[model samples]
Structures are given as structure tokens and as C-alpha cells.
Target: MKNVVLRASSMTQSGKYLLRSIQNESMPKIDLLIRECLQNSLDAAVSRNKGEKVFVDIQVGSCETKKINALFDGLTKELNKRFTSVTVDYISLRDSNTVGLTGPLKEEDIKEEGNYGNLRKLVYDFGQPQVEENSGGSWGIGKTVCYRIGIGIVIYYSKIKLAGNKFESRLAAMLIEDETSPKSLLRSAGLKNGNTSKGIAWWGNEDINGSSYPITDEDEIAAILKDLQIQAYTADETGTTIIIPYIDQQALEINANPYGTLQGKLKDYIGLAVQRWYFPRLYNKEYEFGAYLEFTINGYKIRGTKIRPYFQEMQKLYNITTKAILNDNQNVEKPSDIYIAAIDMNSTFSDGRTAGFVAYKKYNEAELSMLPPNNEPQPYTLLLRDDDDDDTGNMPVIAYCRQAGMVINYEINSAWTHGLPKLTEGEFLLGFFQPNGKKRLRKPDGMSGIEITLDEYLRSTERADHSNWEDKEVYGKKQRIIEKIQKNLPKKIAATYEESAEERKAKADQSLQRNLGKAFLPPSGFGKAAPVRPKTPGKPPATPVFKTHNLSFKLEDMSFSDNGSVCVPFSMTVKNGLDNIHLYLKAHTSQQEIDPGTWEKDIGSNFPAVVLYENLELYLGKVAYTSVEPVYSSKHVCYGIHISQLDSCYNAKGKITLQGKLYFKHNDPTISIRVVAEEGDR
Candidate 1:
């Protein structure tokens, strides 16, 4: 055995791929970035407030060409005592504490206060980057994308400090410019002096230059901070006031004409993106955040209103959350649960994605007759929501996508140039995010909206996560939602076409007769006949003439006892009745009127007297048993003829003459006729 120990190589593995930071200018737009920032602030406020009641004031005006200001404040307090204890070695500590932050951070530590970093500096600055050491910080590079766009940011931090018997308050503001090496500048504007205001003095001396302009009153700053902290009780006074003096170059690029148009568009785009990811900042009561972003041209402030998908419009387009159950286990009291959230919209704007409607339909229908033949499958549209109000937009159209359990977070890329999906003529953009957390986009085809295949979606999900059975659950839920949607599709479509109740009822009745006739009533020894009747006397006489298909018959009436045994008062006449008609009749001497929407067992038959005489006759006129189809279509043949007193059956090879009018008992349920007869010959 070799006794020499294995020696490690002096030179380590090399050639590790170094990812170059893409220039932020290549990003889509600042609108999306600003929106995301504003969202972060709002989320911070909501989390602190315990509800979504934070007020966001956006100012889009300019002291120069144009400026945007966002103020987020709801629940806030003074900085914790720990911040005061934070060591500021300024030399070796700066290098060790510097790297790159995973998320947004205060500027005082990132750059020298009151300094600047232009585009070149941002790219070439050798100064070490400051990284977020806070456990609550986000993944790196997300917010950097915003800063790289050259959009200025100012953050004001206010926190409560708890010291022995005495509380202190403090405010810190740091502003950054869009340059190679951004500078963190502190505004000397809003400052206050109180007994033992050591933290305030220290922060100011380190970050801001003392100034006397703009009413430099320390007492006023303290009062403002005190009042701004909602439900905050601190032994000392503390708060923050952020001010941004510079705007993003891309934001400046947007056209400022049409006051609300630019702002509205940008807001919409940005608002959607913010709605996607989680907002954890709003959960802390120690901080209340909001934004007041304004867009202006020259110096005039521009006004804009938010846009949202109206609930009323949504009601028109699609249904609310739908539920379904799968019958996998018969013994289980609770079947498998499935849920699908889909919004249907008008077909015209579907492709444009201007309307937030989704195309939700069943995947298994052989022929979805409820949908117009021209109609195709489309994906569910994305809806825009404002945590504040609805009716924020005119055009209700917007785009949406879903795959399995995952759906597109419109709030992530609303303002990104490439993020906005395109709409085509007769073709809507469909996006689906599956439970397996995958995304799929589909284009509309023909009159039908875009159709996302369930099989394909499920298959993709299975491939993505083999171990996650929950993916299958998601697919099941989506399928259930689709089924629920399909169940109500006919009614929804009918509502659009404005189909009448009578028409609907008639069609339904016909359908029922065709599909479920055997279940309701089986075929007796009767021939086919159109269920029509000729008006006659309300009650049958003792003996009357029975008129049938071109034939007549007179029969003697024999009166017997009651109890539905035998009652033939006199002779009966069968007129217009065809020859060779086999007839069996029962006479009811009672008189009554049937009420609507009511049915009774043994109710009088609903057949005509003439056709009823045919009894078990299968052939009428020259038409044999096999020729029944042609005779019925020709309209030259008749079936059963039910009289006033009873029903009569008839069938014949040729025309036959009959007798006088027949009578029937009014409101009788037991009398029915089964017969076949001919009406007219060529």
C-alpha cells in the first residue's frame, strides 16, 4: 500500500463564470420600477396598520422640468435603541460592511452624505458596495434594477427609542441620484433640538450640512414627528422626512401632454406589477409607508386617476369563484375539492387584452353548442384591482394568464415594455399559471378565444415537479372550475343573445322529449302522432258523432252505473275518421278546468279524438310501418283524434269519411288516445 498521503493542488479550480451586471438602462422603464418601490412602501404600511387603509399621495409636478414625490406614512415610530449603538468606524468598518444589498437600503451608509455619483461613477466607482445585513432584507439585484435606471430615491426612517425613563426621537433622510456611483445626500430641511437630542445631533453632524433656510426650527420638526406617529408612545421624539430632488431619465422621457393620460397609463402599468409579489414591509407596526408620486411638465403638476376592472363589468363577463367535486371515492363523505377563479369577457376586446376577462370553458365538450360555432377557447383575462377603489379605468380590457396553480403576477411587469402582452385581431392574449408554478401563453384562434389544453398543462406540471402531488390537486381544481364554468355557459350565452323564457322552455321541452322521453313516459301500443287538438264541447253528450280523419262513425250510448264502469248514454258519431281505425274509448261526464303549473296523477289524456281511434295501428294511408317518416314530413297525414268525452284511435291505407263532432270530459287526466290516420291525399 502506498504510504504517501494525497497532496492537494496549490492552484484551485478556476474559470468560474463571472456574470456582468447588465446596465440598468437596458431595463424596460422606470414606471415599473417606481411602481414596485411604491408597492414596497404600501406593503410596509399595510403590514403595520393591520389593514389596507394606508393613504398613498402621489405628486407628479416639478420645480424644474418635472418631479415625482411619494409619501408613505401611517404607523411609525422612533428608531430602536440598537441603531444608536451601531458602531460607525467609518474606515475599516465601511469596507467590511460594504458589498451589494439584496434589496433597498438607507443611503447614508451606501454613499458619503451630500456626495454624488453619475453614470460613469456608478459603473467605475471602486468604492465597495453596501450590502443589507438585516435578516428582513430581500434578494439582491431586484431593487438595483430600479436604481440603475437613474431614478432618484429618498428614504425617511422614523423609529421609537426606549431608554431609561426618557424617550428620544430622530429623523434621517438619504437621497440618491441615477449615476455610476450614486451619492446619498441629506436634506438639512426638517430638524429639531430637544433635551438630550443627542441622536438627532449626531445623525445631522454625520450626514447633513447645517442650514438656516426654509424655517430651520428643531422644535417644529419634533412636533411634526410626534403627530405623525399614530398610536405610538415613545419616551423620546423620532421620525423621518424623505425628499427626492431628482427624477429618472426614463420617466422624463414619457410624454407629459394629456395630463391624466401619461400618469394614468404609468400608474396602471406600475400598479399591476406591484400586485404580484409579497409585501412584507407593511406588516411591521413600527413603520408606516406610502408614496406621493407626481408627474409634471415644465413646472405644472399633472393629475391622473387610477384604473381598475369594475365589478359590474366582471359580473357581465364571467362568474365568481366556482366549485366542483370529483367522484373518485364513493365511500368518502367529502369528495375531492377543486376551485377555479376565472373571468369571462366580451369577445371583441378579448384579444386586445384591454379588458380583464378570461376565456373559461370545459376541455371535454365534443361540441360546445352553447358557444357559437365561431366561438373558440380563450384564456382567463387578468383583472386590475386598486386596494382603494373601483371604476378607476374606462377601458376594462386587460391581459391575464394562468397555467396550473400558478398565475402571472401582473404586478411584476406592468410597465415593462416587453412585459405587456400584445393583442391581435380576433386573437386575445391568454396567460395561464398552473399550480406547479408554471406559465403558459396562448393566442386566440378564429372566433373562439384562446384555448389552453388541460392535458398539456398537467403534463408540463408533472414534468416540472415529479414529487409534488399537490400539482395534481391544482389540476383537478382547475378542471373543476372549468366544469362549473361550462355548466353555466349556456345560460350565460343565452343572456347575451337575450333568449326569451318561452323560447328557452320550448327548446328545453323538446330536448327533454328527445333525450329523456323514455324515462318520463314509455312508448305504449300507440302510433306516432302530433299532439294537437281541435276545439269542441267541454263535456261529452250521452251519444255523439265522432269526427276523425275524413271519416265518421255513429255509436249507440249505453248508460251504466258510476264508479268508472260503463257509461254510454247514446250513439257516438266519429266524423272525418279514416277507415280501418281501431278505437277504444272511455267517456268521462265530469267538467273541470285545469290550472297552470299543476299536474295530477291520472289526469285526462292529451290526445285528439281522431288519432286516438287508431289504437295500435302503425300505418296510415299508403305509408307502411317503415314509411312513417315520409308521411309525417308531408303534412298530409294525421295521428290520434281525442274527442271531448274520450280519446279515439285511427289508421287507414286510404281516405275515409267520418261523422259529427266529438265531445270530451273537461279536465280529465285518465283519458289518452293512441292512433294513426291520414289527413289529405295528393
Candidate 2:
């Protein structure tokens, strides 16, 4: 066995550049590493072996530097120069009950239409498309996450059973670094022969052509595994093992205070990450196609029985979604505390069969405290955290995924969850969305009308990291399936939380007088006692010329703007004849009413910048001087329009209608504006 460092060539990607391909700031680098590795492992599970559970084991430990220094030929001197330690920390991941990288060993043997195999795809290729249908990976760049968490040195070992019951084990290693760096190990190794370094090196058996191939000698593989202190797969076992050497333990524990020790914190994080991304498939037995996932970290098994306190709510939500899909979403019983709804997400580009389901639940502090205590935090806190404000409390979160059962994203304060109601103190809302993978869809015209599953459709919308679903344009037109989902999801959730039967009855009774069109109104004395008049009658008061028959306002929509401001759109109606109307707005809070003029003094922000009325933009703190124009005063927070002015402006005599939006600098959704309409000037 020998080490092979490629010579720099045109358009070649440096190791440092490749390592940064999967950088996700929202999640910790350690968590990202775990997620990507497990996703690939789950995707490689053997499908033919029914009822066989797929198990993944992650071992974190250290090995003496001198013990395995000889494994890397050209990079040994550089390793010793960089790390000043007797032992090197490492992380190993092994998966059982799976197919272990079965494919042609040589690059020239690959074919366009034939199976590229997992071995070549993972070890040699970059950014290749996933050949498997409904697979978790799409861009194939997720493998770079391995290099991100370590010193860019990773070893791969896999054992596959051939057709004749013979077993073959393949072992290889790769080291990546910024070859251009003045302190680069590859540069220090002098492997480039005075030429620029490609920043990549591979270790394996050298063939006659000077090309490196995986070491297939079982004896050699066993010796190396023992030296690295990695648990080897048995002779009869078939799976893959990944070892990343020289890991930064402190880097993995950044910002995490779950445990007192580094190892404890690492273990807690690994377990939480596994449950966060794979809870849907963990111990699930509902779907025959869904593989059960078992996870272990440093010899500690993460089983459903012990981790229930951390993920019980999410598990329940997953069950609700799967059951709805299994029953064809027809007449399925839902839990009283949970609200489940399904939406037909089919569009013009679809085959008229695609659908997505959402389930929502609210938990109070009391209910949350019932879970058993543990060193790690609950999944809700991890899933529903507001990225912008740490102390803003838990916000409404919607965890969404495709049929693969791995969560694609936890959406908070995004367009996908724009209309969800704000959570009050002491409670939070959790929601889950899954597209029906079984539903088939066909592309629109100019694209050959090719059929694809809903799962495939959703996968097309994911970026390389598979973190969020985005809108993609096809044939120069927007697909808009995601748009439709976003637009309809909150409406469905709101409908599920509709008023109770008794509440509806009471509302009906209160509105019955108005619903009867004012014809069946009761007389003043019809059902009451007689009135008492004053002894001396005074001069009757003069009646006003203008009277408002009906005045009402309704909030149409409320949402957060791009700059973290609150936007409110409302509509107001003014019935009957009127000479003038004055609209006063006050900041309404639970404590007191604050006039718009003093909004800045009370709430530390200015009033709405402007109130929009159709094409007329009325700037607050200004006033109108003409019939078609409007203005305001800095001291008085009033918007007044004369009926005679409206008559001359638009020829609408004695009638006025207003609909516009108010843009406030404040972001608190709980704060509202109260509107009071009066006759003439106040």
C-alpha cells in the first residue's frame, strides 16, 4: 500500500474549497456531520432483506499518534509537526444490515446507464446525482461534511458479499487540506515535485498503472483497523465503516453546556442530532417500506424507550402524519390535542394526484414539565428556537420532510410559516408536514410530460444541503407548488382550530339581531320596565346635521416584514350620509391605550410611517390641504376626510370607503392599533 497525491490540474477543486461545500451556519458543524453521515447510511440499507433493522453505531475515542502514524505515508512528518499530542482524537461510524459500496473498483469501468454503485460514488465522485429513487441525498455533496469536522483525513472500510457467498473487504483513506497554505501538510510532504499541489491525497494499493485502488487484503484491513482502535466488521458481516482521525473535541462542544465533561457533551449532542433528524424512522413499524433506524453513541444505545422524554411530542406528530397518509386521508380519527389536515398540492404541472399533510399541537409549560429530566434539552427547544432572538421564547415551528422520513427543515419565521398564529406566554406550537411520496406527478408541456413522484418533486426544490425547500422555475415559469403549499398551510391549521360548538352557538346568538336585517327588532318598552322622566323639561338639544349609520373595521392580515417590522392591513366601512369623518388610532396594549402622537415616547418607536389608502399615500404627522389630498399633525393622531371633498374628488356623494395597510416600526405581534371613528372634527 502507498499514498498517491494528485498533481494540480486546470479546474481542479482544492481540498479546502470542497470541505466548505456543506457549511451550514444554522446548525453546528458537529450536528451537520452526524446528519449527513446517518442520512447516507440509511439510504444504503438493503431493501431485499425484509424486517431486518438497520443499525448505525458511532464510536468516539482516541488512539496513540505513533500507533497509526505509518498508515499515512507521505503525510506522517506533517501530522507530527501540526498536532502536538501523544494521542489523536477520532470518530468512527459503522452501519450494519446494509449493502456496503458494491460497484466496479476502477473508474474506467463505470457506465452511464449501469449502476455506479455506492463505493465509487462516495469515494471518487463529487456532486454526482443520486441513482436511487426517493433517496435522502440529491446533490451528493453531503459527504464533504466528514472533512469539515476533522483534520480532513478520513478512512473508508466496507465488506460486501459477492454472488458466490464469498466476502470482499475494501479499505481506503483520504487526506484533504489547503495545499496553498504556507503550513500545508501536503506542501510540506514534497509530493508535488515543485509543482502546485492539488491539496488531496489517497492511501491504498498502487496498481501497475500507478493509480491507487482500495486495499482488498483482509489481513491488511484487519491490521489497520486494530491499529486505529476501530471495531471491525465480522467475516460474515456486510456494511460500511467511516473513521475520521484528529477531530477537534473542543470544536464539537462549542456553545453546548449539556454535560460537565467533553465526552458527555459530545454524546448528548450526537444522540440529540440523531433523534432530531431521524425520529420519523426510528423504531417506526407502520410502513413496510420505512426502515427502522437504531442509533448508538460511544456504546450507549439511543432507544425509544429511554429517549421518550426528549421526542415524545415529535414522535406523536409523526404517527399522526403517517396514519393520515395510510388511510388515504379519509375519516381518520385525530387526537383531541392534535390538529391534522391534508391538502391537495397538485398543480398544472402535476398528474392531479399529489398531496401534503400537516399536523399541529400546542403544549403548555405544565405538559412540557411532565417529561423526565435529562442532561440534554428537549427537542422542542432545539427545533423551535428563534434564530434572531435568543430570549424571544419559543416560536411556532413547522418541521417538514419528504417520504424519506428525514426532516428537511425546521421552518421558523419564514414564508412557509408566515400566517401561523403567534404563541402566547407559557405555550408553544409544533407542526409537521410530509408530502405523499406515493403520489405520482407528471411534468408540464415542453418538458416531455415525464412522470415523477411527489417525493422527487419536493427533492428537486432542495439545495445541496437539503435544509430548506425553495421555489424552482421550470421552462422559464415558476412551478409554484411550494407557493401553493405555503399559502394554504396556515389556512388549514386555522380551520382545524376553529371555535367549539358552544362558542359558535353563543356567537350566533349575539349576531342573530344583525343577521335578521334589523326588521324584527324589539321595541324599547316591549320587554322592559317603564322609563322615568325628569320633573322639569329642558329645551331639546339641537340635532347634528350629519350622522353615521354604521361604522366598522376588520383586520385583514398581519405579518412581519423583511426588516422585522409589523405590517397590518385593514378595511373600514362608513355607511349612510356624513359630512366629515375623523379616524383616531391609538396603540392598544394590555395595560393602556397610547396615542399615536406619543407612540415613540411610550414604546420607543415612531408611529406607522404612513397609512396607505388606495393610490393615496397619507404620511403620518402631516395634513391634507385639498379634496384629493390628505395630511396629518405631529401633535394630533387623526386622519380626517370631508364628505364634500370626496363628492368633488370622485363624485361619490355622502359615501366613503377605506382600505389600507399600516407599517409600524415595532415587531411585537401582540400590540395592536385601535381605531375610533367620529363625526366631523374633534
Q: What C-alpha lDDT values do all the predictions have? A: 0.25, 0.66
Instruction: Report the alpha-carbon TM-score of model 2 versus the true structure.
Output: 0.71
RMSD of 2: 12.2
lDDT of 1 by residue, 1-682 (tens): 0011111233411111001122323224433344333433332231222222333333322231111111211101111211233221100000001111111122333365524221111221222222211111122223333333332333232333233543333333222222122221111222223221111111221214322112123454454333333122233333222233234423534521112222334434334322222121212122112222222222232222121222112221222111111211112222122113223323322222111123222121112111333232222222322221111101113222221111123322232112222222122222221121112223335434444433333333321111111132331233333233233333332233355869856754553343222211112232333232444689543323334444333444332222211222222223344223333332222343222111112332121111112222232233323222111101112222322311233324333223321222211223332111222332
TM-scores of the candidates are: 0.28, 0.71
Judged by whole-model lDDT over C-alpha atoms, candidate 1 comes out at 0.25
Worst 10 residues of 2 by lDDT: 517-526
Q: Which stretches of candidate 1 lie above 4 Å from their native place?
A: 1-28, 42-52, 63-137, 145-170, 173-204, 207-242, 248-306, 310-682
Residue-wise C-alpha lDDT for candidate 2, range 1-682, written one tens digit per residue: 4888776777877787877777676677766777788878878887624355788999888998876777888777777777768899998899988889789787666676646788878887677767677678888888888876787788999999888889899999887777767867777778763377777888897777666679999899999999898888886888999999988877777634333323346767777777778888776665334467877888778765456453667777877887787776724677888888877664543444437788888876445553234333433455535242222234677788887668887777787677666554345677888777777655656566557666787888887788888877755566777778888887888776677879866654443322222221111112321232444566542211212344444444355444333355545455554445554445555567666556755443335333332333332124332333333435222232332333332224544565655543322334554444455432
Worst 10 residues of 1 by lDDT: 88-97
On a 0 to 100 scale, what is the lDDT of residue 667 in model 2?
A: 28
Best by TM-score: 2
